[model samples]
Target: MINPHKQQIIKPKKAVIKWLLDSDPAIRWQVMRDLTKEPDEFIVAERKRVATEGWVAQLLALQDADGKWGGVIFPAKWASTFYALLLLRDMGLEPTSEQARKAVSLVRHKVTWGQEHGNSPFFEGEVEPCINGRVLALGAYFGGASDQLVDRLLSEQLEDGGWNCEAPPSRRSSFNTTICVLDGLLAYENAKGACTAVTDARLRGQEYLLVRGMFRRLSTGEVIDRSWLRFSFPPTWHYDVLRGLDYLRSARVEPDEQVIEAVDLVAKKQHQNGRWPLQNPHLDQVNFAMEGPAATASRWNTLRALRVLDWYYR
Candidate 1:
């Protein structure tokens, strides 16, 4: 496994870097911190713009007075407040900003899992490992996720060292559910500081991916899902190669033989121009376009892929 430490950042093409930097504050700040290694002050200053500019502003403006987006708690259209929070987390909205505090506070007081889950508070989370995992991440990021939520998630872990929303009937873990839970669990650890149970579960979850080579069926050694090769942003609950690699990068997992194939797939996806195309764009019903339609150069996917590659190669 490769340890990602004070390793030098990889030098992406200047034009590609320019393309990335010239865009939304959400993406630009990440590029500075991860790719360009800008001074923390510059990165912080740029990150603050997310509360006032570009996609972040657009998304925030769509919010209703009720602290809900898309007018639902969790809707099939991805228009729900749940998704809005997820997207905000992905955008790296400055946690301390007034916009973030106000927005999150509204979610905390006004939203609920509805009568179905006993109208559970937003940060308290509802059933379904997939949904709770994302909720855990949002709460942790914005500072509301609870220890009770963490405890519930810990109890639901399947024997396979990962989670499955459909655990009771199938007893088999799922890649989609596993990634969502891992993201939440990791975020919880980062926000609350690691404890033995959370840390152990998180590490075991990583092993589950590593043993399967990230996107393979362990029993037959065949690609589990071809669509996993299609990269996306605001990924929702989907699991893709780039998503898997990016998670490892964020978690600071050491790169090893297990990730070589996945890393190569990301490298191969880059266009001759050095930008990666958006192979998939997870449904956004809110009318906000984070990138051009699929097959076009995508700043979000390109930025994520570049950082993941840097973590792997360095």
Candidate 2:
């Protein structure tokens, strides 16, 4: 006798899986592993192609001989080494690959915070929690020694249980900054485990998001920003409810009452065909088009949303 609940949980939409599998190597690799539960051998084979083909390959090819992209770091929009490294990380590139190793090394030696604080090295990080958070993430993901930087960010957490980039020890936290820092702390802890301080800090930060229900004003229960309802890919510094839920799902967080409203907002955005449209895309320079413009069914957004819902419903 089959368990009907288990069957319902495991059943997948075949058409959606087909559409996702037909995308770039990056997207296809994630779809196979996350949604389809394909065998390890098949997923590894597809993931290997990401370094040599399509947009991921194009971005790798754009790396300069000196190891930086666009010959400068930061302030160059999406064309600099900072954005390039962030993009590569998002594409799930292998941190130990030849290109990635060299790029990480170059960033360590060549890039600096640019005279803002005696030109601190890339991994040393500057004062802002938002910037330091990104540095921690990129450094840890690419195998840089970011322990000191991680400690600094953890200390910067405010009494409110979150971080604000505008000023350290602010009475309140900014959603944008807190999310970025949370992502960084999560990456650091994943790469190098056994730090109880980091774990506690991450939980507090999660509570900060949960207390406000991810998008509402805690005091008034009003939606804080209409833009938080829109979905976007490669979000950069922006914060959205979908992005927040996706992060929570990645962190293996169990569903909580605080997340119900945000989850409903996500479900409400689904189209008749069970797809989510791209509502925003960062308008900046890049290697190539990763997804179609806004208003179209976005493979990136759809993949993220589906997996998020899968975790939520299960």
Candidate 3:
């Protein structure tokens, strides 16, 4: 059982949750599962709404007949087929749904990485591990073929146990790239129990982040970037402390002393009403705004932070 006092410290206030429940289905579905512990029937009903209503529905409706969004695989930053699938995955679309399957099929059969790669985008993947990581995740989550891509990504891991898009010239791994790869590997593993190589690579990648304390420089123990301290939604490919901690929780890793500082930073950001504010939104064009403009109290960030704390304190 979890410690009662610790639970109280991390639990969201009723008003905060009430506010969350009243929000879009994308946010509400996660809140129900992660925070509210709502019954399966209720959670399923709310999740089904994601396919038919609100932001998730709006995004899905934008899919072109060719099954690509914006008529391109990697179109504008946020409107491309890759990003569209990523957003859908984030929105908790039922992967097995007919519409979801069709979209995945289109990417597999119709989409290519262009003349550069001259192959199926999801299967072959692109040059950057950051992009490949996300592709691996989307492919695995949405039932596309990712075996070759997964092997390619794992083979590209740096000696430091992480990945960087700028690999050959700079062997050092990047926080942003590492988090993306971690999300991919984890998603693949959860969907299909694969080989030990995948697990080993994933753990090493995790250690890469852990060594830096999520968002710090190992050499000086200094914060890497000020923006990393700011929490955001639909993190895309960025790395922030909250994103790191939330990934750790999803991977079922226990809290460690190395993460204490980042954990403390998260706790301090909570509003008095037991909510968190959206500090930054990615500059990329999105299908639609999931939360309000920045500096407003954010249900996405609040739910993520609360869950991270819940896992840490438990």
Which candidate comes out best when scored by TM-score? 1
Candidates 2 and 3 compared by lDDT, better number = 3
In the range 1-314, model 3's lDDT, one tens digit per residue, is: 32323545566778888998898898899889988889999999988888888887798889887777887777587888888888899889998877677767776777788887766465568888999998888877877647888888888999999999998898999999999999999998988986699999999999999988888898998888999999988888889999999999999997878788788888889877778899978858677777788989988898898888878887
Arrange candidates by lDDT, descending.
1, 3, 2
**Candidate 3: residue 20 Cα off by (Å):** 0.6
lDDT of 2 by residue, 1-314 (tens): 22223333345467777887888998989988888889999999898888888878899888887767888777777888878888888887878877677767877887787886788888888888887898899888888747888888887889889999875335789899999999999988888885799999999999999999999998998988999999998888899999999999989999878888888778778776757899978868765778888999998888888777778877
How well does each candidate superpose onto the true structure, as a TM-score?
Answer: 0.96, 0.93, 0.94
Q: Which regions in candidate 1 have their CA more than 4 angstroms from the true location? A: 1-9
Q: Give one digit per residue, the lDDT tens place, for model 1 in 223-302.
A: 99999999988788899999999999999999989887787778878787888898867765755777778899999988
Model 1: lDDT to the true structure: 0.87
**Residue pairs clashing, model 3:** none
How high a TM-score does candidate 1 get? Answer: 0.96
